[model samples]
Target: MAIIKLSETKLQELKEVCKSFNNDKGELINVLHKAQSIFGYLPAEVQEVIAKELNVSVAHVYGVVTFYSFFTMTPKGEHPISVCLGTACYVRGAEKVLEEFRRILKIQVGQTTPDGKFSLSCLRCVGACGLAPVVMVGEKVYGRVSPDGVKDIVAEYRN
Candidate 1:
């Protein structure tokens, strides 16, 4: 992963977020969430700032960031794709669907495309078993996805 320099403005914004939570160690998770929102991903530099602001160790902040699937140390694409690998989706051919995405996007799970247009990942469930074989692009959910339909899904955001 490439190292990114955190801008002063964004650093101030992160500090303000921690301040909003009184910089309480108990609110570490909350602070992390808000920090992620500001910086997109929690890089080591951001984590260091957060640790100092919260009066905690950098290890503690890193532990929480890595512990939660919601947090990411690397940046995501403009449109992130998450495939549901839960029982329902898996049994329904989620793996094939995932492969189709890999082929079309030319990127594997947890990787963003070279053009920075899309990123692919897998999750346990999306709470939409009724709509099995689910694929989420950003906040929009695509249900009943099949290998053949992957191209069309990618096309939706190509422009």
Candidate 2:
């Protein structure tokens, strides 16, 4: 992983976010969410800054960040693609759909395309079991996705 340098402006914004929460250690999760929003992802440098501001240990902050699935240390692509691997989706062929995405994008799960247009990931459930084998591109949900349809889905955002 490459080291990230936070700009003074961004660093100030993060400090402001912490201050907004009164730098309360109890609001660590909320602080992390705001920090991630500011930085796109919680890199180690950002984590360190957050730790100092919240008066918490760096290890504690890192533990919280890693423990939550919603938080990502790496940056996500402009279009983050997520596959549902819950019991219903998996039984309905979610794995095949995920493979199709990897084949088409030429990137594995938790990887972003070279062009930074898309990134792939998997989640246990999307709560859309009725529409098994689901895929999500950013905020739009595509239910009942098939391996064959993966190409069209990728093409839809190519332009």
Candidate 2 structure lDDT: 0.94
Candidate 1 minimal-lDDT segment of 10 residues: 1-10
Stretches of candidate 1 off by over 4 Å are 1-9
Off by over 4 Å in 2: 1-10
TM-score of each: 0.86, 0.84
Question: How do the residues 1-159 of candidate 1 rate in per-residue lDDT, one tens digit apiece?
Answer: 466778989998999998999989999999989888897788899999989998999999899999998999877889989999999999999999999999999898999898889999999998999999999999999999999999999999999
lDDT for model 1: 0.92
The positional error of residue 54 in candidate 2, measured at the CA in angstroms, is 1.8
**Cα-based lDDT for every prediction:** 0.92, 0.94
